[model samples]
Target: MAGYLTTHVLDTARGCPAAGLKIMLYKLSGNSHRKLLEVVTNDDGRTNAPILPAESFETGSYELVFCAGDYLRATGQAGDDPLFLDEIPIRFGMSDAEAHYHVPLLLSPFSYGTYRGS
Candidate 1:
Protein backbone atom coordinates (compact mmCIF):
# COMPACT_ATOMS: atom_id res chain seq x y z
CA MET A 1 0.00 0.00 0.00
CA ALA A 2 1.12 3.57 -0.67
CA GLY A 3 1.41 6.22 2.02
CA TYR A 4 0.63 9.91 2.04
CA LEU A 5 2.90 12.28 0.13
CA THR A 6 4.70 9.45 -1.60
CA THR A 7 7.13 10.42 -4.34
CA HIS A 8 9.24 8.70 -6.94
CA VAL A 9 12.06 10.25 -8.88
CA LEU A 10 12.49 8.81 -12.35
CA ASP A 11 15.41 10.17 -14.28
CA THR A 12 13.61 10.37 -17.60
CA ALA A 13 16.83 11.39 -19.27
CA ARG A 14 18.38 8.07 -18.32
CA GLY A 15 15.24 6.11 -17.56
CA CYS A 16 16.66 5.16 -14.16
CA PRO A 17 15.72 5.54 -10.57
CA ALA A 18 17.10 8.69 -8.94
CA ALA A 19 18.49 7.36 -5.72
CA GLY A 20 20.10 9.49 -3.00
CA LEU A 21 18.26 12.56 -4.12
CA LYS A 22 17.57 14.88 -1.22
CA ILE A 23 14.07 16.23 -0.92
CA MET A 24 12.59 18.68 1.52
CA LEU A 25 8.89 19.05 2.30
CA TYR A 26 7.90 22.50 3.39
CA LYS A 27 4.77 24.27 4.46
CA LEU A 28 4.12 27.84 3.41
CA SER A 29 4.32 30.27 6.26
CA GLY A 30 3.74 34.01 6.33
CA ASN A 31 6.84 34.94 4.36
CA SER A 32 9.11 31.94 4.50
CA HIS A 33 8.66 28.23 3.97
CA ARG A 34 8.44 26.04 7.02
CA LYS A 35 10.13 22.71 6.67
CA LEU A 36 7.98 19.74 7.51
CA LEU A 37 10.34 16.92 6.60
CA GLU A 38 13.49 16.03 4.71
CA VAL A 39 14.53 12.73 3.23
CA VAL A 40 16.61 11.10 0.59
CA THR A 41 15.41 8.80 -2.15
CA ASN A 42 16.13 5.13 -1.67
CA ASP A 43 17.17 2.53 -4.16
CA ASP A 44 13.69 2.32 -5.60
CA GLY A 45 13.58 6.07 -5.97
CA ARG A 46 11.15 6.32 -3.07
CA THR A 47 11.38 7.72 0.43
CA ASN A 48 12.01 5.33 3.30
CA ALA A 49 8.61 6.29 4.64
CA PRO A 50 5.86 8.81 4.02
CA ILE A 51 6.80 12.38 4.72
CA LEU A 52 3.58 12.73 6.64
CA PRO A 53 2.84 10.17 9.28
CA ALA A 54 -0.62 8.93 10.23
CA GLU A 55 -0.83 11.17 13.30
CA SER A 56 0.76 14.21 11.72
CA PHE A 57 -1.72 15.27 9.09
CA GLU A 58 -2.56 18.94 9.01
CA THR A 59 -4.21 21.52 6.75
CA GLY A 60 -1.84 23.88 5.02
CA SER A 61 0.05 24.68 1.87
CA TYR A 62 3.03 22.54 1.02
CA GLU A 63 6.03 22.53 -1.27
CA LEU A 64 8.42 19.79 -2.29
CA VAL A 65 11.90 20.73 -3.39
CA PHE A 66 13.74 18.10 -5.34
CA CYS A 67 17.50 18.41 -5.61
CA ALA A 68 17.68 17.19 -9.16
CA GLY A 69 20.89 18.95 -10.03
CA ASP A 70 22.84 17.28 -7.26
CA TYR A 71 21.28 13.92 -7.94
CA LEU A 72 22.27 14.03 -11.58
CA ARG A 73 25.73 15.31 -10.81
CA ALA A 74 26.45 12.51 -8.34
CA THR A 75 25.23 9.94 -10.83
CA GLY A 76 27.54 11.27 -13.53
CA GLN A 77 24.58 11.90 -15.81
CA ALA A 78 24.98 15.68 -15.84
CA GLY A 79 26.71 17.95 -18.31
CA ASP A 80 28.96 20.82 -17.30
CA ASP A 81 26.28 23.16 -18.53
CA PRO A 82 23.44 20.76 -17.86
CA LEU A 83 20.33 22.71 -17.07
CA PHE A 84 19.61 20.90 -13.85
CA LEU A 85 16.67 22.28 -12.04
CA ASP A 86 18.17 23.79 -8.89
CA GLU A 87 14.94 23.32 -7.09
CA ILE A 88 11.65 21.90 -8.25
CA PRO A 89 9.04 23.40 -5.98
CA ILE A 90 5.48 22.13 -6.13
CA ARG A 91 2.90 24.17 -4.28
CA PHE A 92 -0.28 22.47 -3.12
CA GLY A 93 -3.06 22.97 -0.66
CA MET A 94 -4.36 20.53 1.91
CA SER A 95 -7.82 21.22 3.29
CA ASP A 96 -8.89 17.89 4.70
CA ALA A 97 -7.17 16.99 7.90
CA GLU A 98 -8.47 13.45 7.80
CA ALA A 99 -7.71 12.79 4.19
CA HIS A 100 -4.42 11.63 2.78
CA TYR A 101 -2.43 13.75 0.36
CA HIS A 102 -0.02 12.09 -1.97
CA VAL A 103 2.33 14.06 -4.18
CA PRO A 104 4.31 12.29 -6.85
CA LEU A 105 6.95 13.76 -9.08
CA LEU A 106 8.34 12.51 -12.38
CA LEU A 107 11.54 14.36 -13.14
CA SER A 108 14.06 14.83 -15.91
CA PRO A 109 17.02 17.07 -16.39
CA PHE A 110 15.16 19.48 -18.62
CA SER A 111 11.68 19.16 -17.20
CA TYR A 112 9.48 17.67 -14.50
CA GLY A 113 5.87 17.00 -13.60
CA THR A 114 3.89 16.67 -10.37
CA TYR A 115 0.39 15.53 -9.49
CA ARG A 116 -1.86 14.66 -6.62
CA GLY A 117 -2.04 10.96 -5.93
CA SER A 118 -3.77 8.51 -3.63
Candidate 2:
Protein backbone atom coordinates (compact mmCIF):
# COMPACT_ATOMS: atom_id res chain seq x y z
CA MET A 1 0.00 0.00 0.00
CA ALA A 2 1.08 3.56 -0.61
CA GLY A 3 1.52 6.22 2.03
CA TYR A 4 -0.37 9.39 2.84
CA LEU A 5 -0.68 12.13 5.47
CA THR A 6 -3.65 13.10 7.59
CA THR A 7 -4.24 15.39 10.56
CA HIS A 8 -6.84 16.56 13.02
CA VAL A 9 -7.23 19.00 15.89
CA LEU A 10 -9.04 18.72 19.20
CA ASP A 11 -9.78 21.59 21.56
CA THR A 12 -8.59 20.15 24.80
CA ALA A 13 -10.05 23.01 26.82
CA ARG A 14 -13.48 22.52 25.31
CA GLY A 15 -13.11 18.79 25.09
CA CYS A 16 -14.33 18.71 21.51
CA PRO A 17 -13.14 18.55 17.96
CA ALA A 18 -11.66 21.78 16.60
CA ALA A 19 -13.79 22.40 13.59
CA GLY A 20 -13.24 25.27 11.14
CA LEU A 21 -9.57 25.60 11.98
CA LYS A 22 -7.31 26.43 9.04
CA ILE A 23 -4.25 24.34 8.37
CA MET A 24 -1.35 24.86 5.99
CA LEU A 25 0.97 22.25 4.65
CA TYR A 26 4.51 23.11 3.61
CA LYS A 27 7.37 21.27 2.02
CA LEU A 28 10.76 22.28 3.31
CA SER A 29 14.19 22.11 1.72
CA GLY A 30 17.22 23.86 3.12
CA ASN A 31 16.01 27.30 4.17
CA SER A 32 13.22 27.36 1.65
CA HIS A 33 9.61 26.56 2.44
CA ARG A 34 7.17 25.73 -0.30
CA LYS A 35 3.48 25.74 0.43
CA LEU A 36 1.75 22.53 -0.51
CA LEU A 37 -1.85 23.29 0.29
CA GLU A 38 -4.29 24.92 2.69
CA VAL A 39 -7.31 23.21 4.19
CA VAL A 40 -9.93 23.66 6.85
CA THR A 41 -10.96 21.18 9.45
CA ASN A 42 -14.42 19.68 9.21
CA ASP A 43 -16.90 19.07 12.04
CA ASP A 44 -14.91 15.98 12.89
CA GLY A 45 -11.76 18.10 13.22
CA ARG A 46 -10.27 16.40 10.21
CA THR A 47 -9.63 17.30 6.60
CA ASN A 48 -12.18 15.98 4.16
CA ALA A 49 -9.40 14.03 2.53
CA PRO A 50 -5.78 13.24 3.16
CA ILE A 51 -3.73 16.40 3.01
CA LEU A 52 -0.92 14.47 1.39
CA PRO A 53 -2.23 11.69 -0.75
CA ALA A 54 -0.51 8.53 -1.80
CA GLU A 55 0.31 9.67 -5.33
CA SER A 56 2.16 12.69 -3.99
CA PHE A 57 3.63 11.08 -0.92
CA GLU A 58 7.25 11.94 -0.36
CA THR A 59 9.98 11.33 2.15
CA GLY A 60 11.29 14.65 3.44
CA SER A 61 10.81 17.44 5.88
CA TYR A 62 7.36 18.95 6.10
CA GLU A 63 5.49 21.40 8.29
CA LEU A 64 1.89 21.88 9.33
CA VAL A 65 0.81 25.33 10.52
CA PHE A 66 -2.36 25.37 12.53
CA CYS A 67 -4.16 28.67 12.78
CA ALA A 68 -4.89 28.36 16.44
CA GLY A 69 -5.34 32.05 17.18
CA ASP A 70 -8.18 32.44 14.71
CA TYR A 71 -9.92 29.35 16.03
CA LEU A 72 -9.39 30.50 19.62
CA ARG A 73 -10.83 33.91 18.84
CA ALA A 74 -13.82 32.43 17.06
CA THR A 75 -14.41 30.16 20.04
CA GLY A 76 -13.97 33.10 22.45
CA GLN A 77 -10.94 31.52 23.98
CA ALA A 78 -8.38 34.06 22.92
CA GLY A 79 -7.21 36.87 25.15
CA ASP A 80 -6.37 40.50 24.42
CA ASP A 81 -3.68 41.64 22.00
CA PRO A 82 -1.37 38.74 21.25
CA LEU A 83 -2.24 35.16 21.88
CA PHE A 84 0.21 32.93 23.72
CA LEU A 85 -0.44 30.30 21.13
CA ASP A 86 -0.98 31.63 17.66
CA GLU A 87 0.10 29.92 14.51
CA ILE A 88 1.35 26.60 15.78
CA PRO A 89 3.93 25.08 13.46
CA ILE A 90 4.89 21.48 13.79
CA ARG A 91 7.94 20.38 11.83
CA PHE A 92 8.54 16.74 11.29
CA GLY A 93 10.38 14.43 8.97
CA MET A 94 8.77 11.61 7.05
CA SER A 95 11.35 8.98 6.36
CA ASP A 96 9.11 6.25 5.10
CA ALA A 97 7.36 6.84 1.85
CA GLU A 98 5.16 3.78 2.21
CA ALA A 99 3.81 4.55 5.63
CA HIS A 100 0.66 6.23 6.76
CA TYR A 101 1.39 9.35 8.79
CA HIS A 102 -1.23 10.65 11.15
CA VAL A 103 -0.42 13.80 13.07
CA PRO A 104 -2.95 15.14 15.53
CA LEU A 105 -2.97 18.31 17.55
CA LEU A 106 -4.31 18.54 21.08
CA LEU A 107 -4.87 22.23 21.63
CA SER A 108 -6.02 24.77 24.13
CA PRO A 109 -5.92 28.54 24.33
CA PHE A 110 -2.64 28.53 26.20
CA SER A 111 -0.96 25.34 25.14
CA TYR A 112 -0.89 22.49 22.64
CA GLY A 113 0.55 19.07 22.07
CA THR A 114 0.91 16.65 19.16
CA TYR A 115 1.80 13.08 18.47
CA ARG A 116 1.94 10.53 15.69
CA GLY A 117 -1.43 8.90 15.85
CA SER A 118 -2.76 5.86 14.04
Candidate 3:
Protein backbone atom coordinates (compact mmCIF):
# COMPACT_ATOMS: atom_id res chain seq x y z
CA MET A 1 0.00 0.00 0.00
CA ALA A 2 1.05 3.61 -0.58
CA GLY A 3 0.38 6.85 1.27
CA TYR A 4 0.02 10.51 0.37
CA LEU A 5 1.13 13.79 1.96
CA THR A 6 -1.26 16.69 2.43
CA THR A 7 -0.87 20.16 3.95
CA HIS A 8 -2.80 23.30 4.84
CA VAL A 9 -1.59 26.79 5.72
CA LEU A 10 -3.62 29.00 8.04
CA ASP A 11 -2.34 32.46 8.73
CA THR A 12 -3.25 33.00 12.34
CA ALA A 13 -2.28 36.63 12.06
CA ARG A 14 -4.31 37.25 8.99
CA GLY A 15 -7.09 34.84 9.72
CA CYS A 16 -7.29 33.53 6.18
CA PRO A 17 -5.74 31.27 3.60
CA ALA A 18 -2.20 32.43 2.96
CA ALA A 19 -3.34 32.81 -0.61
CA GLY A 20 -0.08 33.66 -2.36
CA LEU A 21 2.50 31.83 -0.34
CA LYS A 22 5.01 29.71 -2.23
CA ILE A 23 6.14 26.34 -0.91
CA MET A 24 8.38 23.39 -1.83
CA LEU A 25 8.67 19.77 -0.77
CA TYR A 26 11.77 17.62 -0.62
CA LYS A 27 12.00 13.91 0.00
CA LEU A 28 14.92 13.20 2.31
CA SER A 29 17.92 11.27 1.04
CA GLY A 30 17.60 7.54 1.16
CA ASN A 31 17.27 4.56 -1.15
CA SER A 32 15.05 6.79 -3.18
CA HIS A 33 16.66 9.47 -5.32
CA ARG A 34 15.48 12.18 -2.88
CA LYS A 35 14.52 14.90 -5.27
CA LEU A 36 12.49 18.08 -4.75
CA LEU A 37 8.80 17.26 -4.64
CA GLU A 38 6.74 19.40 -6.97
CA VAL A 39 5.85 22.71 -5.24
CA VAL A 40 2.24 23.82 -5.34
CA THR A 41 -0.34 25.60 -3.17
CA ASN A 42 -3.84 26.94 -3.65
CA ASP A 43 -5.94 30.03 -2.95
CA ASP A 44 -7.32 28.39 0.15
CA GLY A 45 -3.84 27.99 1.66
CA ARG A 46 -3.88 24.31 0.84
CA THR A 47 -2.33 22.40 -1.98
CA ASN A 48 -4.49 21.84 -5.02
CA ALA A 49 -3.93 18.19 -4.19
CA PRO A 50 -1.72 16.03 -2.05
CA ILE A 51 2.03 16.48 -2.31
CA LEU A 52 2.79 12.79 -2.74
CA PRO A 53 0.86 10.61 -5.07
CA ALA A 54 -0.54 7.45 -3.55
CA GLU A 55 1.34 5.02 -5.79
CA SER A 56 4.91 6.30 -5.34
CA PHE A 57 4.89 6.55 -1.55
CA GLU A 58 7.57 5.13 0.75
CA THR A 59 9.17 5.53 4.17
CA GLY A 60 11.57 8.46 4.50
CA SER A 61 12.00 11.97 5.81
CA TYR A 62 10.36 14.88 4.03
CA GLU A 63 10.83 18.62 4.29
CA LEU A 64 8.30 21.31 3.53
CA VAL A 65 9.64 24.81 2.87
CA PHE A 66 7.05 27.52 3.29
CA CYS A 67 7.83 30.81 1.56
CA ALA A 68 6.94 33.02 4.49
CA GLY A 69 8.89 35.95 3.11
CA ASP A 70 7.07 35.75 -0.14
CA TYR A 71 3.76 35.51 1.63
CA LEU A 72 4.48 38.50 3.85
CA ARG A 73 5.95 40.54 1.06
CA ALA A 74 2.92 39.98 -1.12
CA THR A 75 0.57 40.67 1.73
CA GLY A 76 2.54 43.60 3.16
CA GLN A 77 3.12 41.69 6.38
CA ALA A 78 6.89 41.51 6.27
CA GLY A 79 8.28 43.87 8.84
CA ASP A 80 11.43 45.98 8.72
CA ASP A 81 13.26 43.54 11.00
CA PRO A 82 12.08 40.44 9.18
CA LEU A 83 11.66 38.76 12.55
CA PHE A 84 9.24 36.34 11.05
CA LEU A 85 10.97 33.14 10.05
CA ASP A 86 10.80 33.11 6.29
CA GLU A 87 11.73 29.55 5.47
CA ILE A 88 9.75 27.26 7.72
CA PRO A 89 10.71 23.62 7.26
CA ILE A 90 8.83 20.67 8.65
CA ARG A 91 10.78 17.45 8.44
CA PHE A 92 9.04 14.17 9.16
CA GLY A 93 9.03 10.50 8.30
CA MET A 94 6.44 8.74 6.22
CA SER A 95 6.90 5.55 8.22
CA ASP A 96 3.48 4.08 7.79
CA ALA A 97 2.63 3.20 4.23
CA GLU A 98 -1.02 2.62 5.08
CA ALA A 99 -1.60 5.99 6.74
CA HIS A 100 -1.96 9.41 5.15
CA TYR A 101 0.01 12.38 6.47
CA HIS A 102 -1.33 15.87 6.81
CA VAL A 103 1.08 18.66 7.72
CA PRO A 104 -0.81 21.72 8.86
CA LEU A 105 0.75 25.11 9.55
CA LEU A 106 -0.60 28.06 11.52
CA LEU A 107 1.63 31.09 11.08
CA SER A 108 1.90 34.71 12.04
CA PRO A 109 4.18 37.64 11.36
CA PHE A 110 6.45 36.50 14.15
CA SER A 111 5.84 32.81 14.63
CA TYR A 112 4.65 29.57 13.07
CA GLY A 113 4.03 25.91 13.80
CA THR A 114 3.88 22.55 12.10
CA TYR A 115 3.44 18.91 13.02
CA ARG A 116 2.46 15.49 11.75
CA GLY A 117 -1.28 15.65 11.30
CA SER A 118 -4.05 13.37 10.18
Candidate 4:
Protein backbone atom coordinates (compact mmCIF):
# COMPACT_ATOMS: atom_id res chain seq x y z
CA MET A 1 0.00 0.00 0.00
CA ALA A 2 1.91 3.01 -1.19
CA GLY A 3 1.27 6.15 0.84
CA TYR A 4 -0.39 9.42 -0.16
CA LEU A 5 -2.04 12.44 1.48
CA THR A 6 -5.46 13.91 0.74
CA THR A 7 -7.79 16.42 2.34
CA HIS A 8 -11.38 17.70 2.11
CA VAL A 9 -12.98 20.76 3.59
CA LEU A 10 -16.68 21.20 4.40
CA ASP A 11 -18.26 24.55 5.10
CA THR A 12 -20.47 23.80 8.07
CA ALA A 13 -22.02 27.22 8.02
CA ARG A 14 -23.18 26.97 4.43
CA GLY A 15 -23.75 23.21 4.53
CA CYS A 16 -21.75 22.68 1.37
CA PRO A 17 -18.28 21.87 0.24
CA ALA A 18 -15.80 24.56 1.20
CA ALA A 19 -14.85 25.52 -2.31
CA GLY A 20 -11.94 27.94 -2.81
CA LEU A 21 -10.37 27.34 0.57
CA LYS A 22 -6.59 27.58 0.58
CA ILE A 23 -4.46 24.80 1.96
CA MET A 24 -0.75 24.63 2.61
CA LEU A 25 1.21 21.50 3.35
CA TYR A 26 4.44 21.56 5.35
CA LYS A 27 7.02 18.98 6.25
CA LEU A 28 8.37 19.41 9.76
CA SER A 29 11.65 18.04 11.06
CA GLY A 30 12.83 18.89 14.57
CA ASN A 31 12.60 22.67 14.89
CA SER A 32 12.74 23.14 11.15
CA HIS A 33 9.69 23.38 8.93
CA ARG A 34 9.61 23.34 5.18
CA LYS A 35 6.64 24.22 3.02
CA LEU A 36 5.78 21.37 0.73
CA LEU A 37 2.86 22.58 -1.40
CA GLU A 38 -0.07 24.96 -1.52
CA VAL A 39 -3.41 24.31 -3.16
CA VAL A 40 -6.98 25.47 -3.28
CA THR A 41 -10.08 23.40 -2.88
CA ASN A 42 -12.15 22.73 -5.96
CA ASP A 43 -15.91 22.73 -6.40
CA ASP A 44 -15.96 19.49 -4.45
CA GLY A 45 -13.96 21.02 -1.61
CA ARG A 46 -11.04 18.76 -2.35
CA THR A 47 -7.79 19.11 -4.17
CA ASN A 48 -7.70 18.14 -7.82
CA ALA A 49 -4.96 15.75 -6.77
CA PRO A 50 -3.57 14.44 -3.55
CA ILE A 51 -1.81 16.97 -1.38
CA LEU A 52 1.18 14.67 -1.28
CA PRO A 53 1.43 12.41 -4.24
CA ALA A 54 2.43 8.79 -3.71
CA GLU A 55 5.97 9.17 -4.93
CA SER A 56 6.67 12.07 -2.59
CA PHE A 57 4.90 10.63 0.43
CA GLU A 58 7.12 9.81 3.44
CA THR A 59 6.81 8.74 7.03
CA GLY A 60 7.27 11.86 9.13
CA SER A 61 5.51 14.71 10.82
CA TYR A 62 3.55 17.04 8.57
CA GLU A 63 1.23 19.99 8.85
CA LEU A 64 -1.78 21.18 6.82
CA VAL A 65 -2.62 24.84 7.23
CA PHE A 66 -6.16 25.75 6.23
CA CYS A 67 -6.87 29.42 5.68
CA ALA A 68 -10.35 29.40 7.19
CA GLY A 69 -10.61 33.08 8.04
CA ASP A 70 -9.86 34.24 4.54
CA TYR A 71 -12.32 31.80 3.12
CA LEU A 72 -15.01 33.03 5.43
CA ARG A 73 -14.29 36.64 4.65
CA ALA A 74 -14.27 36.03 0.94
CA THR A 75 -17.57 34.22 1.19
CA GLY A 76 -19.06 37.12 3.14
CA GLN A 77 -19.57 35.05 6.24
CA ALA A 78 -17.09 36.53 8.66
CA GLY A 79 -17.57 39.62 10.83
CA ASP A 80 -15.32 42.66 10.68
CA ASP A 81 -13.78 41.97 14.07
CA PRO A 82 -11.25 39.30 14.96
CA LEU A 83 -11.98 35.84 13.76
CA PHE A 84 -12.10 32.96 16.17
CA LEU A 85 -10.63 30.54 13.72
CA ASP A 86 -8.01 31.70 11.29
CA GLU A 87 -5.31 29.61 9.78
CA ILE A 88 -6.13 26.18 11.09
CA PRO A 89 -3.03 24.07 11.21
CA ILE A 90 -3.48 20.35 11.60
CA ARG A 91 -0.24 18.62 12.54
CA PHE A 92 -0.04 14.88 12.15
CA GLY A 93 2.44 12.06 11.90
CA MET A 94 2.82 9.37 9.28
CA SER A 95 4.31 6.29 10.86
CA ASP A 96 3.72 4.08 7.86
CA ALA A 97 4.79 5.03 4.39
CA GLU A 98 2.43 2.53 2.84
CA ALA A 99 -0.76 3.92 4.25
CA HIS A 100 -3.23 6.41 2.87
CA TYR A 101 -3.69 9.56 4.93
CA HIS A 102 -6.98 11.40 4.57
CA VAL A 103 -7.34 14.50 6.71
CA PRO A 104 -10.78 16.05 6.44
CA LEU A 105 -11.73 19.39 7.92
CA LEU A 106 -15.23 20.47 8.99
CA LEU A 107 -15.13 24.25 9.10
CA SER A 108 -17.17 27.31 9.87
CA PRO A 109 -16.54 30.96 10.52
CA PHE A 110 -16.21 30.51 14.28
CA SER A 111 -15.34 26.86 14.70
CA TYR A 112 -13.78 23.92 12.97
CA GLY A 113 -13.04 20.25 13.45
CA THR A 114 -10.87 17.67 11.78
CA TYR A 115 -10.24 13.95 11.92
CA ARG A 116 -8.38 11.12 10.33
CA GLY A 117 -10.38 9.68 7.50
CA SER A 118 -10.18 6.62 5.31
Taking the tens digit of each residue's C-alpha lDDT, what string does model 4 give over 37-66? Answer: 999999999999999999899999999999
Cα-based TM-score, every candidate: 0.86, 0.98, 0.88, 0.97
Compared to the true structure, candidate 1 yields what TM-score?
Answer: 0.86
Tens digits of per-residue lDDT for model 2, 2-114: 88999999999999999999999999999999999999999999999999999999999999999999999999999997889999999999999789999999999988999
Q: Which candidate should be chosen as best, given TM-score against the real structure?
A: 2
Q: 56-77, model 3: which lDDT tens digit per residue? A: 6776888888888778877888
- Provide the global lDDT of candidate 1 against the true structure: 0.79
User: How many residue-pair clashes does candidate 2 contain?
Assistant: 0
Per-residue lDDT of 1-118 in model 1, one digit per residue for the tens?
A: 3224567777777787888999999989778898988999999888988787766766778888888888877877666774557678888888776676777778776788877777
> How would the candidate models be sorted by TM-score, starting from the highest?
2, 4, 3, 1
Which is better, 1 or 4, measured by TM-score?
A: 4
| Model 1, position 17: C-alpha lDDT score | 80
Best by lDDT: 2
Q: For model 3, what is the error of residue 108's alpha carbon versus the real structure, in angstroms, after optimal superposition?
A: 0.6
The local distance difference test score of each candidate is 0.79, 0.97, 0.80, 0.94
